[model samples]
Structures are given as structure tokens and as C-alpha cells.
Target: MVGTYDLHYYQIDQIKRVRIVRRSDGCYVQFCIQADRNVDIQPAGKTIELDVGLSAFYTDSNGLKVDNPRHLRKSEKALKRLQKRVSRKKKGSNNRKRAVKKLGRKHLKVSRQRKDHAVKQALCVVKSNDFVAFEKLQIRNMVKNRRLAKSISDAGWSQFTQWLEYFGKVYGRIVVSVPPQYTSQNCSECGEVVKKSLSMRTHICKCGCVLDRDHNAAINILDKALKQAGYQLSTVGHTETHNAWEPLRW
Candidate 1:
């Protein structure tokens, strides 16, 4: 069996278990190793809240927008071609089986891409901030809308959040999931309710807080999380110097 084993580089002294799986490309062997590693948590660091969406992968409290690399959407045409090719093949034929395998491989590639992106992005976010806050999104319920179901699924918010939580546990970071209620409706600067429809992208508050809806929500999410964690906000007025946070186009 062809395999990759580099224990010296990993400093893996003991193998506890191993599992092998066959894929369309080749066989994959997973090794479970036992080793000592140091995982330290910083007590004081920058806090950030994220508002995830289809417009961008996530908009942070710092107004930084991470572009969503929609892998499935990008490969949709190729996937459709592969599916069409498979449908045209005769049942119980070798060609049919090969076509199916090719389709499966393409799907596996997309899944891997989504997972890789989520892991890297989550790791970076967690490492940069001591406390990470985000909306507790109910993806299953949200996807019930037929119009947005495809886009919501393609965003892979659940996968990204899972990795964020996993990494948070591993690195001893504080990850908080706040209630989604009024996060967008409530003005981030003036504590006023700025009601808006789903079509509204900009949050225009009567109190003079004009900002991107998602960016405002992100700030509110961070504020809510900080309050829950006993971090008090300054009572100073919402001056530009105090509340200069706004979305910047990349």
C-alpha cells in the first residue's frame, strides 16, 4: 500500500490508532498520534464580532470584510456538466461507474475546499482576538426559504462556525454566540431602533449613525457579548472619535 508516514517531522512517538479509507483518487490512511503540546491562551487581546452573510464571508467589528470564496457556486457549471455526462451513460456499464466516480471526486474536492477555507479563516480570527462573538444563526430554519436556500448552503456558515468553536476550545479562546434578535435593527452607535427591510443594505439611523447594516450588526454583537462578559462600554457620547467604526470597501 502506498502511504505517507513522517513520524520524525511530527515528533510522533506513539501511534494510538489508524483508519484507512478508499476514495476516488486513492486510499487515505489516518494516524492518531499521542504527543505533548502546549496550548496557551492570552488573557488580554483584541475582541471582535463577526456578521456572516452571502455578500461577504463575514464582516468584523473592525469593519474588515472577508470575501466569501463560494466554491460550489464557482464549480456549479463543471458539476452540471459532470452530472449530465453521468446521466447520459448507460446503467450497469463501466462508463457509467467511471462517470459516477468522477462526479464524486469533484464533490469531494469542493467539500475539502470549503473545509480548508473555514479552518484557515477560523484559526486566523481566533488567534487575532481573545474574545470572538457572533450571531447564533439557525441555518436549518434560515434555509427553509427556497430563494435563499442555495446561497445559504453555499456559504457554509455551519462548517465555519464548527471549526471556530473547535479551534476556540483547542486554543482556550472565548467564543460567544449572542442572540440574533435586533442585532441589525438596533443602531450600533446611538442605541436607537432603525427598522429596515431585508432589501436595505445601509443602516440609516435618526441619530446620525449611517453605516452598513452588517457592520452595524457586528458592532452590536460585540457589544452584547462584551456586556455579557462584564465588559462595560464607555458612557461617552457617540462622537466620531468614540464610534469611528464603519465598513470600508476592499
Candidate 2:
């Protein structure tokens, strides 16, 4: 795979494997169904063992692209069923323990599925290109955004970055984290900061450039990082910082 080292476009695929051999009706066990390199076994005791696996993904034109329609649907249904069961369980009863176990198993399944999705997307991007760029959003703060909380978490951009970094080390691919600064606001054409509401999907700049908000942001972040040596982005308008990091943290 030395040629992968010199390739300008690569389609890297990242996948996460989870060990979830549990059941709901007590008749079936469901291990992670996503693509996996394989399974690793490490002994702990006479009978106990551990399974370890890493998540993977790639990038794309719009951004990181990972999709698994069937797997996602299955995970969603299991989660909904588990949620209802947990919600009905009594506070400190044995039923609660059962419910919690079921819920935990469900979460493990979903987490693996999600991580797989992210890795697949990130890998695609990385393998498709020599240089991969993604927005460095403050994941903690973004999760608090009431409107986008679910979708943002579902997207798992932060996890995607972690996977990208892992492959970057192993593959020697250049994975870059660009600033989550005024990527959308700042005009890519003339650098004018066009203020837009959260609802604004199109970045309409006075410089006559109209681009998808996220794409605009992505391109700007990429260019800015390319321009700056130290490569720090001004998160002046994107974050919710309370300290003295003006023009750097919102």
C-alpha cells in the first residue's frame, strides 16, 4: 500500500466495532453489524476476555460523509423500544436494573453504529484527497444548541475528527482541523463578515457569493488554515466563551 502514500485522492473508510451480544426477548443476541477489520481477544481471567476495536471514516465534498440507512434504522428502533422500557421502570426496583441493562445495550449498539457511520464518511474523504479539512467546532457547546442538538450529535463530527487523527497517524495522511471561526459569515470572495441567523442556510455576501452555509464555512476554514502558519482561527462569532479571547472565542 506504499502507493497510498503518494496518492493525491484516497477514499478512506473508518468503521467501529462493538461487542453487544445481548437480547431483548431473551431469544436473540445482536453483535455490531457494521464493517470491521476483525476482532481482538485479550484474556482477563480463566473465562473472561475483552474485545477491542477502533472506529474509522473519510471526508467528502459537502463534508464528512458516513451513511448506513439500514443500520441506522435498526439502531433507532432498538433505542426507541429501550427508551420506553426504561421510562416505565420504577426508580430502584429490579425492573429498573433490567431496563437499565437493556438501555445500556441499546446505547452500545447505537454508539457503535454511529461511530461506524462517522468513520466511513471520514475515511472516504481522507482516501479521496491528499489533504483533508474539517471544521473544529466546540462540540460541548454545539451539543447545547437546542435546535441542532440531536442532528449534531447524530452527525458525530467530533468523533469523526478523532477517527481522522487516528488514520492520519497510521496512514500518514494529512488530516487537518480548521478553525470553526466565521466560516459562514466571512465572505470567501472578499472577506466581509455577513451576519446570518441560525436559520440562514445560504450565505449571501455583498461580494455576490452565495454558498451553502456549511460549505462556505468549510472552504473559508480550509483557506484560512492554509494561509496562517500557526493556523489559529478566530472563533469570535461562533463560540460561547465568557473569557478574554476576543476575535478568537465567541
RMSD of 1: 5.8
Count of clashing residue pairs in every prediction:
0, 25
Report how far off residue 113 is in candidate 2 (Å): 0.4
lDDT for each residue of candidate 1 in 27-63, tens digit (9 for 90 to 100) = 8888888865447866434667899876889998778
Q: Residue 42 in candidate 2 has what lDDT?
A: 26
lDDT of 2 by residue, 6-38 (tens): 333323332234343345434332323333342
Best by lDDT: 1
- Compute each candidate's TM-score over C-alphas: 0.83, 0.60
Please identify model 2 stretches exceeding 4 Å from their true place: 1-80, 87-96, 229-250
lDDT of each: 0.80, 0.54
Q: What lDDT, from 0 to 1, does candidate 2 have?
A: 0.54
